[model samples]
Target: MSLAADLGIAFGRVAFVMLFVLNMGGLLTWVERKQSAIMQDRIGANRASILGLRLFGLFHPLADAIKMLTKEDFRPARADRVLFGLAPFVSVFFALTAFASIPFGDTLRVGGREIPLQAVTLNVGVLYVFAMLSLGVYGVMMAGWSSGNNFALLGGQRAAALMITAEVAIGASIMGVIMVYGSLNMMDIVRGQGALLWGWLPAWGIVTQPLAFVLFLTAGIAATKRIPFDMPEGESEIIGYFVEYSGMKFGMFAMADFLETVVIAGMTTSLFLGGWQVPYLDAAGVRLPWGWTWALPHLLVVLLQVGAFVLKVCAVIFFMMLIRWTLPRFRYDQAMRLGWLGLFPLSIANIVLTGLVLLLWGGRP
Candidate 1:
């Protein structure tokens, strides 16, 4: 391909990914409010509407965007101006970029050209995601330290601690899946999972590595800093690392959190839920094992794969939101203990068991 062609493709993929992430982040604000309201038995975000059309509080996120844009961007009296300004951007940037390596679908063949459905297909896709997740902590630390407030600093310290504890478990938990798949590439892992088990069950990551699924989900939730693990931003206790931020600056921090949630959902879908892989649906169409066959057009097949992946990600995101409302916030000590003393050790044991199972089987999981 020519340089210009490559550049255009890169730009197109980047724009597509960013738009999806940003829209999902905005939508999740409404999801959070409505979800919590449903759980609490109260009306939520119904006041905002467009020309008398409420649309089930969908316009509330639009109203919020307008408000944030018009609101004054405030700073602390003694804050480090540069780092304070950069912190939220860093958080948002890493959160959005982390999804680049995740494969949303198998591939699209158009006019003799095969287009991979991911923004960037890195050989070390899992490691790249892990790196981005790790860097997200620097944003929290910077925001807290630069805010020139003791509470903000404490929140930053808490965030740092949470990341350290949770990441170890996250890494260990995913290690078993990586070993089972025998590849670090996200697409490779998904393709491997597309195979059938006993010519009937879809050999998904969840089926082959159930323990990793549980461990990864646990660690992933802690990494997001949501309810039951939100020590860093315990709204009732402290204003959090971005306590001094206001307007869109603060909005960026909030958006980062939501975007991170989406990333987690996508990762969980790709790693555990059969990403874009419909049961019995292949490049041609549905092929049953009982001598039955139904062929589908290539376009329809691609769409089905893409739709399946999106649906799975959305389901994961909804589950995460449900968890947010259902669970109570954990105390600092409790959260730490759960991470280090519980998840970490369990993840290690899971890896050992996985290794043993793989050794005995000596075949693809």
Candidate 2:
């Protein structure tokens, strides 16, 4: 294929993936609300329907989009209009960009052409993910500061500090993963997990690094600034960083939250649950019969691998959504304490323990 043609094909495929992710995230907002309402024993969004069709709150997302579209797109008179416009855009844009390096699934082959699901397989994918996640704070900070509102400023300050506290612990917690895998490439980490531990439990990161998994989960929750770590946008006591934002602008920030959830879920799959490789599935992938030729085996193998990957990703997403609804929001000081005094020490301990495990097991994990 010509280089230009190849580039076009790659872009087209990526566009499709982005659209899929977008629609999924939009749906998730309604799901989160409906699920949250169900937990609280109330009708979440039954009032929002189309043609008298409730569809179990399926139409809520469309309703939300319309509301955001018609709402006044107002800016504070004293706010920096340029930065105000850019703030949510920055938040949503970085959230989307962070997904670029993730390996969603394995490659598929058709007529001798193989297409990989990952957008860009950068060598420093892990670092890049972290960097983008950290940068997410700036969007909030800018939004709050540029609003020229005291409440917004306070929220932004809280967000910055909250992010730093959680990020340090989060970064420390994942060091063990790096130590074990010895590579920053997320694809390689998943590939490493395909082996079995003593022929039993899969050698997924969670199996081998159980403590790290817990710590990582905790920090991830805090990093994403959801409940139990939502000090930055505590709706009750303090207006959130984006309090000044409205209309589709605010919708972008809301959408970014859902996208970040998906990103985290996907990363969890790649990091701990073994990306696209089921136990015993080799790096090149499994094989099956393609009618009457050798191509059959290759096709089957690829199909199995894709199935495995989707299963893993779905499992992760379910777990995250469960956590979101099950937990209560943490108070600002409590969240801070958990991040610093609690998670920080635990993360450091995990690093130390991981080293010992590596020394004893010769890094087989």
Candidate 3:
């Protein structure tokens, strides 16, 4: 194929990922509420109706989208109109863009076409994700500052500081997996896990880098600012950067949170769970009969991988929510102290241990 054609195909993959994630966000809305309800031992949000028929809050996400659309658009009288408008776009854009470097499946066969499941295979895919995540603080900071609300400014500042602390730990924790897998491309790291261990355990990031897994999970929760670490937008106190925002404007930030949930899940899949690589399936189960024939199994693998990825992410989200409902929210000082002093030291220790493990296993066949 021509170079232009190749580039087109790659961009098409990124578009496909965006569309796929949006649909997942729809389903995830239902799953998260339903699961959260179960965990809390109460029925949560199950009463939207279509001609007097209710579907267990399943239709509520649609209900939500419509409600957000119909709500009155509000802007603070003194708010910077342009920046107020731009903040949500900034949030949603980064939420959507970060997935480009990650693959959803192994490979597929179509009509004489062999398509790799990842959108763009860069050598620094994981590092690239971390960098994008760091930049996301701007969205919050801009929204809060532009709103001219003291509370919003405080919230945004808090979120920015927390993001910086969390990212260092998040990056440090994942470095262990990168060292073990020996690649930054999402697919390569996953494929590396296809190796067997005593016919029982697959060489997953969790099994090898257990310490990093904990650290990554911790940093991830803090980074996303779920309860216990949510000094940024303590929903109960309503100190979020969007304090001055309402209607569709505030909805945008909520949408970003939902989408970032997807991103974090994807990252979890890529870093620790072996991504789209299902365990024990040989590359033989998927054969590229024709150059284009790779599309079918490619689709299947992508579906399964994406499915597994979503599940892992949901599990984490559920756990996070459980903590939210089960545990009391941390005081802002405690939250900051935990992120900087606690996670920083623990992350450094994890890196050293991962290095020692690599040296010990370097001689393995």
Candidate 4:
């Protein structure tokens, strides 16, 4: 409608997405502890509470926030003050912005005006998200180099190397999905997935590009720089890129990691797990393969799509956490080998195979 209304809608969408991303990032700190506890057969983070309200350590994140806020903001005496101060913000900013292009649901029609559920709609959303994620490396490098610490510099070098190895594989891995969807738009890709194959199976990326799914997920985990790929922050060795950071600055770096995890999960859900698409469910309602149709209200349909997307993202997050507990950290050399000699070539092969299959089939299968 009017320019003001359009701006208002855009602002609203941005607000909603930011709140969701930040809150999830915070909650994931709790999830990580609790999930790890259950897996290791121990109680975790249950001590933080207020007025006899434990809430199963739900208050830990809140307690963490307060502690970080009140802690002394420290900087190394030899550090470059400007870049050292700016790095954490850069990391958090890019991580949060990357989620802007992710579509949480389909269009929401209200008062005869259609509003997209995503914060931003881009013709090249995949590239946009990837670029944002790649930019985060600068923050890591900045944090390490500006800290004026030898250990931090070494950590930065490792981080850069790991990022390079993983990013190449990640870029190559998504090529097959692009070929299958035949569009760079994230919404287009998700919409393409809603179609049924053989009038029975949903045409999700996992079905069409199963190899890409596995490769992307593997590379995505490496990109997040978590356990088994966390040589950049080898705490066991008492070193890291942000080793000199303290207080909220350090918190920002930690938050950035969790935010990246959420972004990776969102990307996996969007690219391979059908995004907001529900089985047999369209904008109007559910139309089963066996001639059964259930018409749902527009609001309900939107809610269902959004809910499905949320659930899928959560499931992916849970799986990632499970992997975190299950696997031991890989040695740097082994991690690099897996990314370069293993995932990279496999991703390239997957692309070629996808191309051949599409050529023979004449379209998505």
Listed per model in order, the count of residue pairs whose N, CA or C atoms clash below 3 Å is 0, 8, 17, 0
Better of 3 and 4 by TM-score: 4
Q: Which residue window of length 10 is worst by lDDT in model 4?
A: 231-240
As a whole number from 0 to 100, the lDDT of residue 199 in candidate 3 is: 54
After TM-score superposition, what is the CA distance of residue 110 in candidate 4 from its true location, in Å? 0.8
Candidate 4, residue 57: how far the Cα is off, in Å: 0.9
Candidates, ranked, TM-score: 4, 1, 2, 3
lDDT of 1 by residue, 1-365 (tens): 66687688778777777888889999999999998999899998898877899999999998998999999999888999999999999999899899999987778876676778899989999999999998999999999999999989999999989988889999999998899899999999899888988988888989998988988887898999888789899877656887888899888988988998999898899888988899888898999878699999999998899899989999999998888888899889998999999999999998899899999999885
Using all chains and alpha carbons, the TM-scores for the candidates as numbered come to 0.97, 0.90, 0.89, 0.98
Q: Name the candidate, 2 or 3, with the larger TM-score value.
A: 2
RMSD of each: 1.3, 3.6, 4.4, 1.0
**What overall lDDT goes with each candidate model?**
0.89, 0.79, 0.78, 0.93
Residue-level lDDT tens digits of model 4 in 181-202: 9988899999999999999999
TM-score (C-alpha, index-matched) for candidate 2: 0.90
Query: What count of clashes does model 4 give?
Result: 0
| Candidate 4 structure lDDT | 0.93
Which consecutive 10 residues in model 2 have the weakest lDDT in total? 287-296
lDDT of 2 by residue, 122-237 (tens): 79988888888889989888988999999899988998898888778878887888888888988778777877776555788888778878887778877777776777887666
